[model samples]
Target: MNTAAYFAQIYREPDPFQYRQRWYEARKRALTLACLPRQRYRNAWELGCSNGVLSAALAERCDALLGTDLSAAALADAASSTAAFANVRFEQAHHPQDWPTGQFDLIVVSEVGYYLSAPDLSEMATRLRTSLADDGLLLACHWVHPFAEALSSAAEVHEALAGGLVEAFTYRDADLVMQGWGVSPTSVAACEGLR
Candidate 1:
């Protein structure tokens, strides 16, 4: 199946990923947010923001936020899900091919990298160098356990990110791997002159 059809089927359910109702999803969002070195970003972009569960929370931390998804149905859900946030907007885009123009201070690829094949993910990683600002942060979170829909492993996805990217932070559990990267790196305390 193509990207749109696959996601179309997935979005048929009211909450296919159980992001709103699952402790795992909720806790994952908290962990993702907690891992950010900076409290606020000038501009943030999330790739494959299905249903916008995380996007809603990110909106609170970003001056301007863009959430991209492949399916119109999913974008509709995302739009409504983040409707209260005037700073947030939803756009339809296919990955790698339609990456938005301009740089972003915060770029998130959570749960979406493994869906791409290794070559595609590699291309994405390459594009990220140019897409991200010099002082920007790029984060990715993915399930460590293999699933049928996963075309690549979490390791392969993160490995792609490691090329030319400085690791800013890392978190690993048996179930998930989360990390943040940048060109020039510093700890949260360092960014705040606490160190």
Candidate 2:
């Protein structure tokens, strides 16, 4: 089945994903949030924000946050859940092709990379390169287990971003893996006192 269909099926009845009750997901989200380079961000974008649980957490640190998902049902749930946060917005968007314009100080890819084909993920990374602002941060959190529709493994997706960017942080557990990257120039400077 296609990525959209597969996700639609999950959203139709997401108990199997167990995003809320599972300790694995909670731990991964915590790890993802901890690895961020900055304590606060001006603008943040989270693609494939499955029900907006993490998006709500991201809203606390971001001045403006946009969370997108392909499933309408998911978006509805997200909107209702995050209604109190005026800075948080939810939309229905697909990746690589339907990406929103403008630069973001923080970009998050959580549990979404495996849906795309290798080439598509590469293109998404390229787009991320251009869309990300200087000193911006990118966080990728993915499940470590195998799935039938996944085009690439979590390691491969993390590896694709290595050559072009600098790895800032990483957290791995039995259920999830998280990686953080900062673009060149400011990358090393941020490590030193230059920035």
RMSD of 2: 2.7
**Candidate 2 lDDT, 1-195, residue by residue in tens:** 487887788788854477789887787778778777677899999988888888888999999999989988888888876888999988798888898878998999987878878898898888888888877988888888997878888888877655587777878878778888878433445665677
- Misplaced by over 4 Å in model 2 are 14-16, 184-195
Task: Identify the candidate with maximal TM-score.
Answer: 1
For model 1, the local distance difference test gives 0.91
Name the best candidate (by lDDT): 1
Q: Report the CA-based lDDT of candidate 2 relative to the real structure.
A: 0.83
- Candidate 1 residue 46 Cα shift, in angstroms, is 0.5
Taking all chains together, each candidate's TM-score versus the true structure is 0.97, 0.90
Cα lDDT tens digits, model 1, 34-153, are 998899999999998999999999999999999998888878988999999999998898888888989999999988888887788889999987899988999999999998888999
